[model samples]
Target: EQKAVLVTGCSSGIGLRLAVLLAQDAKKRYHVTATMRDLRKKDKLEQAAGDALNKTLSIQRLDVCSDESVAECLNNMKDRRVDVLVNNAGVGQIGPIESLSMQDMQKVFETNFFGAVRMIKAVLPDMKKRKSGHIVTMSSVMGLQGIVFNDVYAASKFAMEGFCESLAVQLLKFNVNVSLIEPGPVNTEFEMKLMEEVGKSQFPGADAETVRYFKEVYLPASHEIFTTLGQSPDTVAKATMQVIGMRLPRLRYQTNALYTPLVALKYADESGSLSVRTFYNLLFNFGPLFHLSMNLIKCITCNCFRRGAVSPS
Candidate 1:
């Protein structure tokens, strides 16, 4: 029996790629319902899906923020049964907290945290009845370790992490597996757009020195880290596939190994000061040295992958 996979936010980036990948599976193991907020923005997904469209894959209209939209999309399905639900819909936010409005912060949680919960709630009852299902969420390393300037965004993911962790224990008895795909920096248009927007945004309440640090120091360092350590959306999609294929999916899976050490810093010292000081030094005290080290690691890792000596994941 083929699994019915419903993926949200399939217009572009990791969501679109994952939808196409699963739909194009040679074994025909999955029937993908690739959904987006607006069908008008589906040209990219259609082009990528090509022959898979209307065959192994179908596009549906789904706005995660709306209960009516989510319910309607699922109801449209033949059996309204979602064997695998991929909650890939999300939004990103950056810059200082003072500059961020309450509305803007609410929007982030609406899509990133509440949206996932909405979908899970809709499908979980059916999954519970069937005694089986898989729920996969697109989380970030920020969920485990918050970064400066990404306070709200990190909080949203942290909320997701906690929500899923608590829910997973109860779902285990019902044979419904819940997994979080935590990736480091992913090179996608969503990321590039955020970078461009942040450059133009004004931090009204922040001091001049803080604003300068954000623009001059933080932005450049962040760009370098993304350039040197970022994973392609396809890389993340592959990790999602791995999670889906597993007989018993783990609660958390980090997509990028390069970020393992950074996440470890948080656990290594419960004092919390270790991760904070490490990031401070890397961004301020040893900026140049940190950049050099990152570049060296990127070179070596790329070479190793090219030689087939290491897995990109």
Candidate 2:
């Protein structure tokens, strides 16, 4: 039986491209199951595979947020064993903490954290039976270090990182590999969708001043970073295929320009002196520098009492 890989969120961006690229690999050693929340949106994914592709990619329906949907999708694939599973379905949100609600945080977790867990639960039985598998969680650079206005989204990635870490230890006995893709910012509808979701998740009960601040200071600054720094999904897609194929894949993969420097800083922080780089990282991440001003603005405007706001999924 040919080995198969299962990837979620294949309707667009990285998930879609990864499926297509893996399907077109010259060796054509693996079968690919490209799953999305809806089959109707698969035309572009189909196009990406191209008419002359040597590999096979079958589209399937998988809404990670729904247990029934996940179970149903898994049941349908009973005959086909999955060797690699990529949990790539995620949403992003940004806003003033006061204007964001608990519901917003829960919703983000529902899709990004809990949803991934649900999918794993659905597939683990089969993998356990075979004593082998590879699980890929699409995390972000934000997963390692906090940044401005990406509270909800970053938290979700952070949650996944921790989960994947513990899962790696537990699955070692079974030779089930767990890896995280911590790409910086990939150019995709993800950014735009984050903006839109944050806007919609605003609290109606928030004071007028709070609302005004979110409109003026918070969202724009947050959106600007994503708009400018993100890379093409194709870059990550190709890298991801390589990640799955490796016999001894690293626990985490960072595919961005600043990753090397950031990794260096990780050692710096661990060593001794709070160097300029460490200081700047602290200032930007949690200290009273850029985000401090934004938070102050939000506190005054949105009546926000917290530093981080959550977004609805």
Candidate 3:
């Protein structure tokens, strides 16, 4: 029986591309199960594979948000063992913390963090029972360094990185390998979806403070950075496939263009060459300074107002 690799979020983006590439390789390397949140999206997944490659790919429904859904999906595959599970289903919510409620943060985690966790739990039993399997997580550079207006999304990715790190250690004894792919912004529907969701939260009023804030603070940079810094999602998908085939895969892999720069920055700080970190520090310092200046002004105003009319001694 050919080894089976299950990839989540195959409806589009890196997951979909990864599924197709894995299925199309002439070796018929593995049976690719391309699972999406909805079967309707499977048509596109299948289309990505085309008639010839589609034979190697199987589309399935996998709602990572629901435990029952995850369990049912796994149970249905009981006849075929899953040799590798790619936790790629995720959502990105970007907006001001003040505007987005706690529910908004929770929603991000449900799909990006806990959703991966749920899938891991569902597949681990089998992976452990077999004492052989690989678990791959899709993380982001934001997981390494947080950025503005992406606090919730960054937090979820951070959680994934940390979980995968710990899991890598724990799973080694079971002969199961765990790996994390931290990519920078990728050109995909994923980016558009994030922008759309964030844009939607701006309330009805055209001139409302929330809308104005998003326009002034978030939109400009996300637009510039995403377009300028982003790379094709296939870059990440190919990296994932490479990692999966490694007999002794590294604990973590960084495939984005920024990966090397970030690593250099990380070690530069440790080695006392502070150039890059200093640059970033200077870039981010304005936010704190601006907040401090605001508080200082408020204090001065309150003090002036509280000064009762001077008594004419």
Best by TM-score: 1
TM values, all candidates? 0.95, 0.80, 0.81
Q: Candidate 3: list runs displaced more than 4 Å.
A: 52-54, 78-80, 203-214, 263-267, 270-313
Model 3, 120-206: lDDT tens digits are 888898889899999989988778766656789989999998889888888999999998887777899987887677666654333
lDDT of 3 at 182: 78
- Candidate 2, residues 170-202: lDDT per residue as tens digits? 898898999998786678998777666765675
Off by over 4 Å in 1: 296-313
Estimate candidate 3's RMSD in Å.
14.2
For candidate 3, the TM-score is: 0.81
Tens digits of per-residue lDDT for model 1, 27-60: 9999999999999999999999999999999999
The residue pairs that clash in candidate 3, if any, are: none
Q: In what order do the candidates fall by lDDT, top score first?
A: 1, 3, 2
Residue pairs with colliding backbones in model 1 are none
Write the candidate numbers in order of decreasing TM-score. Answer: 1, 3, 2
